[model samples]
Target: MPDSVLVAYGTTNGSTARIAEAVAEVLRRDGLAVEARPARSVTSVTPYDAVVVGGGLYTGRWHKDARRFVRRHRRALAERPLWLFSSGPLDASASERDIPPVAGVRKAMDRLDARDHVTFGGCLEEGAKGWVARMILRSGKGGDFRDFAAVEAWASRVGAELVGEWERSR
Candidate 1:
């Protein structure tokens, strides 16, 4: 029901950014104004009526930018309609089952009273940074496991809830 929404993401190698964009696209389709931006680049959350925050998980921790963003804007974020998401898990488990938020993200969700949280399959491919990524690629364990259909499906649900809330408020 918010006229404006912010989809902010923290991504390493850009996979999480794409996921954030997909969420923004769905929200826009549902007749809301949405902007998707990197979490580090977002200076404030005050301009938006609602917010969706996402981070790429690394060693069970949310990206630093995401963690900082939440900490920096905790008060504003807590006052708004907020949702959280994580992008990680190189396997299909995220799509197959409910992947709970990592401890840090879970704490943030609780502190902010976020409406919901979801985890999506992560993408790891050629040209990824870090030795671990290289090792994974060399070991032939890397692939694009991101399911856009599933992403869209989840976004549709979020959009519906927001739209429904807006209609009722009117």
Candidate 2:
């Protein structure tokens, strides 16, 4: 049987969730069974052969839910093939060039031995939950900056690599 993969994300205004869903779709196309879920809602990571965790960047920090999910499932995550991602740069920078993960994410990657990390653009729209989000929208800096093409390309690479590894093992 093919391996089941989990794509979990933490999002404040829902953009990160969309990115995660896009990633999952690519992985599915690559022949892996994939599930995309909110990081906070996932009860366990034991069922998945590999994991992709993503969060929205917030004030130089990763989203709280993603951080907590990693902390809570550290042991399980460490044993799995893991990847991390952060989305938050309300501009074209992410599409233009690579953006490094934040400090906490770097530490988590090191400790968990994650295979890769990526930073995609973010979105700030009206009705976003926090005062900060509202302020950004008020300033006219809010728009959907996520590049689905880039996101799918990255995910295809990941899915290809994972599938190759699984095939070789069998």
Candidate 3:
């Protein structure tokens, strides 16, 4: 229920950034001040009332920047409300159960007392690669599986709680 939020994300091919932007848009719509930035670019979360950290899951681990962001700001984040997210799993079935597989991040979440962690379906453009991607796109396989509706819905829910918390404090 912070008046402001910082959405820090780490992305490789940029899918994670898009997801973070979508979440930021929803939070802004809810009348909360929000800033979305790449995790590596963020040096501090001092100005924000809440923090949302997310990253792309690659090879059963979160992107390094995102992990480092949490580690660097763990003390500050633990003093405020925090949330975590991971964007990966090109298929619906896989996304439903996709959680970052890192003990360090899990420990970080525990330290921050994170409010929640969500896994969202991701997009891997076949066009992003050369020949293989084109073939996949043509076959309509492994395209963008991200559900914008779901992302917005979850963001809206978080917004409601956050706004309510702010109001109560006021």
Judged by lDDT, which candidate is best? 2
Candidate 2 global CA lDDT score: 0.94
TM-score, candidate number 2? 0.97
Q: Candidate 3 residues 61-114, lDDT tens each?
A: 787899989988889998888888887776785446545535656777788899
**On TM-score, who's better, 1 or 3?**
1
How does each model score on TM-score?
0.96, 0.97, 0.85
Residue pairs of candidate 3 with colliding backbone atoms: 126-133
Compose the digit string of candidate 1's lDDT tens values, residues 67-149: 99999999999999899999889999998999999999999999999999999989889999888778988998888878889
For every candidate in turn, the CA RMSD to the true structure comes to 1.0, 0.9, 3.3
Model 3's TM-score against the true structure: 0.85
Worst 10 residues of 1 by lDDT: 141-150
Candidate 2 per-residue C-alpha lDDT over 1-170 given as tens digits, one digit per residue, 9 for 90 to 100: 34699999999889999999999999999989999999999999999999999999988999999999999999999999999999999999999999999999999999999999999999888789998888888999999999999999999989988988888988
Worst lDDT run of 10 residues, candidate 2, spans 1-10
Whichever of 2 and 3 has more lDDT, that candidate is 2
What's each prediction's clash count? Answer: 1, 0, 1
lDDT of 1: 0.92
Show where candidate 1 strays beyond 4 Å: none
Q: lDDT for each of the candidates?
A: 0.92, 0.94, 0.82
Scored against the true structure, residue 152 in model 1 reaches a CA lDDT of: 86
